[model samples]
Each structure stands twice: as structure tokens, then as C-alpha cells.
Target: MIEDLQKYYGYLFEEALLKEIADVAIAKDIKANDIIIDIGSYITSIPLLLSGAIKILREDKEGDDLVLYYIEKGDTCAMTLSCCMGETKSKIKAVAETDVRLLMIPKQKMSEWLSKYKSWQEFILHSYHNRLQEFIDAVDTIAFLNMDQRLLKYLKDKALVNHNDIITVTHQQIANDLHTSRVVISRLLKALEKRHKIELHRNQIKLLEL
Candidate 1:
């Protein structure tokens, strides 16, 4: 665990801070599609990603989840930071996008380490800024782009995140994440294929332009 922590996060903190984190943090592994945190759940700890990716989602009024962002290796959920410091229930849901390894730090250490380590303070602030920008980008994509454009962007983003141009996903899964119907997603996917933006297989979509 100490070696994993250093491999992922050593560059972000000093030797002393890294040592403290390894000593105090509890490590855990979660399988893909598992819920790490659910809406209204008490957040006792903040997770630092050691490997794989976690998708952060926001629930709509109708109990539908909308994908907000992805936290990859070396990243932490900024919303978790706010919930931890506020001592409140998690408002957003976090799900493992792939099999993931995480380091959970007790919420009480947030302030303690914030004031004690300059690197920790900067890390927290930087996380907040990144999340804020992702929120803005999500809004802009939804408000200004058409459904097809949004679909294309979504595929491109997924490809970039997974580090593969070929994304293995079903149209139904895409619909669920985008909060739409499978039929609609299927139509859009075929249209994209005709446009040469992507190549559709039985259960995979290979990005061509991106």
C-alpha cells in the first residue's frame, strides 16, 4: 500500500506527508460498477484514487443519474472533500468505472493536514478548481450542443479516458449514462456510423475522428 501510494501520489506530497498518509489511510479495492458512495450516505472518509477510474454522478429530480465527471489515477473527488469538511451526507454518487484501488483518509484529517502541509492545501484547492471546470463544461455541453453532438463528445471523452479509441459498451449502457432511451441511442449511434465518426460493432463503438 505504501508503494502504491507513492507511485500514484508521491509527487503531490512531501516525504513527511506521504509517510503520514501511508500510516493513517486505509486501502480498499472496489469492483467495476460497484457503488462507492450513494446519495444521502454518510461520508466518513475521502477517497484518493490509486488505480482505475471512478465516475461521479449527480441525481436529477426524477431519480435519474447524470454523469458528471471521472476521477482517474492520482485524482480525488472534489465533492467528497466538501462533504467531508461539512460533515454532511454525500449529495452525489460515486461508482467504480473500472476495478479500482483507493486509499480512504478519515474526514477529521482534512483540516488537520490542510493547515499542516502546504502541498495538501494546494492539492485540495486544485481539486476544487478542476471539479468546478468540469461542472461548467458539462453544463455547456448539455445546453449548447445537440443530442448527436453530445453523443459524439461523450464517446470521444470515454475513449480519451480509457486510453482506447475502441470503446466496449452497449447502446443501452450509453443511454443509461446519458439519461435517455436505448432506441434513441441506437439511432444516434447508427447516424454517427454513417457519418464516419465511428464504427459500430455488436457491442463496441470505435471512434474514427477522435
Candidate 2:
């Protein structure tokens, strides 16, 4: 696993640093829909995604959750970094969007590596920047776009991240992610279908265009 990780861009640290990571990091394989990090849970390690995708979500007080962004192969979870850096509990949830494999670096090493390794610092900073931009984009979508537009954007994002135009998800699931009612989502989705933007099936949505 160490040798395999060495070939990745962000994991190309110095030999000593690499050795340290190999010694302390634990590799985990998770299946789709598995909850990796739950709100209010104290995090002990930061995960480095090696394959598949993870969806980061923030839940409202009423228990409705909205997907903040996705972390795919070669990406790290910035929400996890915040928890580890502050020694606090997680404010967001991370769920496996597909079968995933990742390496978890202990929280202590996360802090140590920030100062000891240049590569790790750069990687973390880049992740933060990307996540922040995604948040900004999401905000813009909510503020400036209508429900139909938002649904289209959401479907496009899911398709892009999953590397397929076909998405296997339910209308209720889409409503949950977008923080809307299932009835509203169903109506908007039908509008999208009428416009030839997507084709809907039983628990599936196939994008016809962006």
C-alpha cells in the first residue's frame, strides 16, 4: 500500500515523511452509503482518498442535509482538516458515494506534518481553496438560480463526479440533497424531462445534456 501511495501526486513526500505515514496511517475500504464522519463526532485521523468518491454534507437543525461538495481520488477532506487542527468534533458528515479506499493519518501526525513537510502543507492548502470555491459556487447557485436550474446543476455535478451520465438516485434523495420537498423535486424533474435535459427512470436519471 505504501508503494502504491508513493506514486500519487500529494503523497510524494520525502522518504522519511513517507515512512512515517506508512507506519502511522491506516488503510480503510468503505462501501457506498457508509457514513465515514458524522456530525459531533471527534475525529482522530484525516483521510487521504485513494479511489472512489466521498460526499461531504452539512445538516441543518431540522435534520435536512445538503451536500457541500465531493472529494474524489487525489483529494482530501477539508472539513476533516478543520476538526483535526482545532481538536474539535466534526461539524459535517462524510459518506462514501461509491466503493472507496483511503489512508487515514493520525491527528497528531497531521499537525506535525503541517510544519515538517512542505508537500503536505501545499496539498492541504490546495484542498481548502478548492472546497471554499465550491462553497461559493453553491451559494451562487442557490441565490441566483431557480429550482429547475439548481436541479440541472446538481445532476450535472453528480454525473461529472461519478464519470457517467446515468445517475442511480431517487427523487426523494435529490430532495434531501437540495433541501426541498419531494413533490417540488418531482415537479422540477418532470419539467427537466419535458425540456429534454434528462431522462428519468426507476431510481435513475440519465442526463441528455448539461
Candidate 3:
């Protein structure tokens, strides 16, 4: 685990700081679809992803979830940082999108590192900036883009994040992520197929073009 940390975060921090992180961070492995954080839950630690991916989601009052963005290897969840710093509950949810390994730093250690290590401060700030940009992009997509365009973009993103052109997902799952009806998603997917943008099969989509 220390070696993995060094591989991902070595250049970002000094040797001493890296050592401190290795000593204090708790390493854990999680399976796909595991809920890492839930809405309104207190965050006691911040995770540094070592491998695989996590999908950050926002849940509505009606218990619907919308995909916000993905945090993959070498990334951290900025929402976790916000909750830890403010000692507040998390409004967003994080779920493992694939089998994942991560190192968790306790809230106290996270606070201490921010003050003690310049690199740590920079890392946190960078994560916040990236997440904010992603949020802005999502807002623009929802407000300006049509559903077909949005579905295409979503598929492209999922393909890129998973590093596979063939996506294993159901139309209903895509509908849930896009906050639309399964029938609508199915129709749009068929339209995409007619345009030669993708190939659809039972519960899977093979992206043929962007």
C-alpha cells in the first residue's frame, strides 16, 4: 500500500510528508457498487483513491440520484474535504464504480496536513478547482444541451473514465443517471444507433463514435 501511495502521490509531496501519510492513512479495498458516502452522512475521513473509480452523485428529495462526476485513481473527492473541514454532513454520495483501493486519512490528520504541508494544501485546492469546473460543465450541459446530446456526452464520459469503448450498463441505469424515463433513454439510444454513433445489445452499449 505504501508503494502504491508512492506511485500515485510521491511526486506531489516531499518524502517526509509522504512517509507521514503512509504511517497515518488507513488502507482499504472496496467492491464495485459499494456506497462510500451517503447523503446527510458525517464524513470522518477523506479518501485518496489508489485505483479504480468512484462516481460522485447528488440525490434528490424523491430519492433519485444524478451523476455529478467521477473520482478515479490519483484523485480525491472534494466534497469529502468540505464535510471534514466544516464538520458537517455530506450532501453528495460517493459509490465505487469499480473495485477500488484507497487510503483514508482521518479528519484530524487531514486538518494537520493542510497546515503542515504545502503540497497537501495545494492538492486540496486543486481538487476543489477541478470539481467546481466539472459542476459548472454539468450545469451547462443540463441547461443548454438537448437530451440526445446529453446522452452522447454521458456515454463518451463513461467510456473514457472506464477506459473501455464497450459499456456494460442498462438503459434504466442510464436513465437514472440522466434523470429521465427508461423509455426516453431507450428511444434516444435507438436514435444514436440509427446514426451509427453506437451499437446496442442486451444491457450494453458499444460506442462506435464520439
Candidate 4:
């Protein structure tokens, strides 16, 4: 767990500060399907992913689940910021997508560390900027891109940089991330496969076969 923290923090911070930060962090291991946060529950801490995956989701008024995004290792859930700001209600639920480990940071200590540590401040600022850019991209995709275009772009983006192919995401997971129907994703995958552009394995999708 500490190794993951070092790997994540080392990108924007020094080892010393990460050691200090880890001092106050409570390492926790959670099982798959665990609900980290409920729709209306108050969260007193923020958890940094150390291993495995999580997802941010919400149930609409009609009780249909909408998945906002997947949180892989090193991703922090956005609900923490809302809770820190004293929001009365949670806009999303955070659930562990796999057996996961996290480094839990209490809000009060995190606030103190942010104020005192220059490295922490820089890390937060950089993270916020990247997150904002992602938000902008998601909004643009939803507003302007067609479903096929969105799916293609997402696959290309997630594909290995060198290969621009060979993505391994599942259809249901992609549907959740894209806010679309799984049946639609299945149809799209079939079309792509028929065109010899991709192939579907048991749990993985391989792209750019041609």
C-alpha cells in the first residue's frame, strides 16, 4: 500500500512529504462490491486508491444506475471534495469494483497537510487541473459526439499509446463509462468485429485487428 502511495505521490511530490503524509494515512483493504459511500451518507475522509478499482455511480429518479466513471489505482473519488465542503447530500455513490486497498486520509489532517506542505499544494493543484480537463472533455463528448464516435474515441484513447489498439475493457464496463446501453455496445462491438477492426475475447476486447 505504501509502495503505491510512493509511486503516485512521487510523480508530483518528494519522498519526504509522502512519508509524512503516509504517517497520518490509514491503510484499508476493501472487498469487491463494497459500498464506500451511499447517496446521502456523510463521508469524513478521502480515500486514495492503492490497488484495484472502484466506480462512481448514481441511481436516477427512475432507479436506473448511471455510472460516472471508473476509478483505477491512484484515482481519488470526487465525492470527497463535496463532502469536505459540507454538502448535505451526495450526488454519487462510490463502490469498489474489485478487491481494493486504500490509504484513507481524514479531512482535517489533509487540510492541515495541504496548508503546510508545498508539495501537497502542488499535487492538489495539478490533480485539479487534470480532473477539470477530463470534465471538459466528457461534457464535449456528451454534447457533440455521436454514440459511435464517442465509443471509438474512448477505445482509441484507452488503447495502448504505442499500438493504438489492443484495448482490454469489457462491454458492460465501457457502457457504464460511456453512459450508454450495454446492448448498444454489444451491437457496436459486433459491427466492429465484422469489419475486421476488432475482436471480442471472453472478457476483453481487442481492437485494430486490421
Candidate 5:
């Protein structure tokens, strides 16, 4: 796990410098379908992805998951940023997409390390900036994209997670993600399937190549 971290960020840091930060890392196992962190909760820790994937999301008023993004290998789940900023609440829930292993770091400890470790500090700063940008992009997409385009984009993006041409996202989940009605999503999906643009496989969809 440390090797993957080093490989990903080695260009930005000296080997000895990164090793000192990695020394404080600890691993945790999360079962598939488990909630790694709940929405509206408090957190003072962050998790570095070691294996598998995670979904950062929240439920709509109708109680369906809305996927914000996928956190895969070598990524960091930094819910504690808001917590540290005194938000006192999490904006999203994080769930294990598969059985996952993570390196847990306490927020205070990470801050202390960053004060002494320039490379690690820069990595954290960059990650926070990227996350903020992602949120902004999401807001823009929601404001501008139609339901079909939004769903299409999501399927294309999530296809990488499934490791197949097919994607296993439910219509209800799509509705939540797109902030639309399930009936509307169903009608659009059916039309797309008939047009041979996609193949519906129960809850999953296989997007046809253009």
C-alpha cells in the first residue's frame, strides 16, 4: 500500500520524506455494502484507499443513494475537512463499493505531520482543492445537463468501476443522482434501449458503443 502511495506521489516528494509520513499509517478492513461513514455525522479522521472502491454519496428525501464519486485505489477519503472547518456535519455518506482496505489517519495527527512534512502537506492541499472543484463541476452539471445526458455521463464514468462493458446502477439510484423522478428515468431508459443505444440487463445497463 505504501509502495502504491510512493509510486503515485514519488515525483512530488523524496523517498525518505514520504517514508516518514507513511510510518504512521494504519490499515482497516471494510466489508462490502458497509457504511464507512454516514452523512450528517462528525469525523476527525481520513482514509487512504489501499484496495477496492468506495462511494461518496447521500440519500435523497425519498431515500435513494446519490453517488458523488468513486474513491478507488490510492485515493484519500477526506470527510474530516468539513469537520475540521467546524461544519460539525458531513455532507455525504461514504460506503464500501467492494470489500475495502484503507489506511486510517487521525485528522489532528495528519495536521501535525503536515506542519513538519512539506510534501505531505502539499498532497493534502492539492486533494482538498480537487475535491472542491469536483463539487463545483457537479453543481454545474446538474444545472445544465438534461436527465438523459446526466445518466449517460454517469454510466460512462461508472463503467470503469464495474470492470465490464455493463454498468450495475439501478434506475431509482439514477433518479436520486439526477434529482429526477423514477418514472421519468424509466421512460427515458426504455427509449434509449429501444433505440439500441443501450442494453438493459435487469438493474444494470450496457451502454452500446457509438
Candidate 6:
């Protein structure tokens, strides 16, 4: 666990802080598609990603989820930090995009370490900045891009995060992430297939010229 912590976070934290984290943080392994955080749940810890990817989502009024972005290894979720600091229930959902390894630090340590460690404070602030930019990108994708373009970006992102060109996912799952109907997703996916951007299989989509 210490080696994993140092591997992912050494550059961002001091040796003493890293040691403390290894001692106190609970190391966890989450399988793909598992819920890391759920809407309306009280967040109790902050996760420092060790490996794999997690997708952050926002729920719409009709209870559909819209993918915001994916966080890979060596990243911490800003939404989790916010929930910890504000002492509020989570408004976002974090789902494991791949089998994941992470360290969960007690939420109370967030404030304590913020004042105690310079690196911790800087890391938190930087995480927030990065997350805000991702949110802006998500908004831009929804507002400026066409549905097909959005779907293309989504597929590329999934491939990138999963570290595989061949993504194992269904059209209906894509629809759920994009907040659209499965029929619409299936139609657009076939169009992409015709354009030679992707190859559709039984339940998977292989990225091509994308």
C-alpha cells in the first residue's frame, strides 16, 4: 500500500505526508461499474486514485445520468473534496470505469492536512481547477457540439480511460450516459459505423478512425 501510494502520489506529497497517508488511508479495490459515490449519499472520505478510471456523472430531473468526465489514476475527485468540506450529501455520482485501486482518506483529515501540509493544499486547489475546466468542457460539448460529435467524443474518452481501443459497452449504456434514448444511440452508432469511425459488435464498439 505504501508503494502504491508513493507510486501515484510521491511527486505531489512530502515523505512524511505520504507515510501518514499510508498509515491512515484505507486501501480499496473496486471492480468496474461499481458505484464509488452516489447522489444524496453523505461522502465520508476522499479517494486518491491508485489505478484505473472513474467516471463522474450528474443526474437530471428525470433521474437520467449525464457523464461529466472520467478521472484516471493519480487523480482525486474534486466533488468528493467539496462534499467533505461542505458536510453535504453528494450531488454527483462516481462510477468505476475500470477495475480500480484507491486509497480512502478520512474526510476530517482534509482540513487538518490543508493547513498542515503545503503540498496537500496545492494538490486540492489544483484538483479543483482541473475539475472546473472539465465541467466547462462538458458544458461546451453539450452546447456547441452535435449529438454525433458528442457521442464520438464520449467513445474516444471511454477508450482512452479504459486503455483499450475496443470498448465493451452497450448502445443503451451509451444512451444512459448521454441522456438520450437507446434507439437514438443505436441509430447514431450505426451512422458512425458507416463512416468507418467505429465498428459495432454484439455488445461492444471498437474505435477506429476516431
Per-residue lDDT for 1-210 in model 6, tens only?
Answer: 888878889989999999999889998999999999999999999999999999999998889999999999999999999999999999999999999999999999999999999999999999999999999999999999999999999999999998889999988899999999999999999999999999999999999954
Q: For each candidate, what is the lDDT? A: 0.91, 0.89, 0.92, 0.72, 0.74, 0.94
TM-score of each: 0.97, 0.95, 0.98, 0.76, 0.82, 0.97
Residue pairs in collision within model 5: none
lDDT of 5 at 16: 70
lDDT of 6: 0.94
Best first by lDDT, ranked:
6, 3, 1, 2, 5, 4
Give the Cα error of residue 204 in candidate 4, in Å: 3.5
Query: Candidate 4, residue 4: CA error in Å?
Result: 4.4
Give candidates' CA RMSD values in order. Answer: 0.9, 1.5, 0.9, 3.7, 2.8, 0.9
RMSD of 6: 0.9
Q: Lowest-scoring 10 consecutive residues by lDDT in candidate 3?
A: 1-10
| Model 1 Cα lDDT, one tens digit per residue, 72-137 | 989899999999888889999999888898999998888999999999999999999999999899
Q: What are the per-residue Cα lDDT tens digits for candidate 4 across 148-169?
A: 7787767765553224466656
Name the lDDT value of residue 158 in candidate 1: 85
Output the number of the lDDT-best candidate: 6
Candidate 5 — which residues are off by over 4 angstroms?
Answer: 1-13, 17-22, 59-65, 85-87
- What total of clashing residue pairs does each candidate reach? 0, 0, 0, 0, 0, 0
The model with the greater lDDT, 3 or 5, is 3
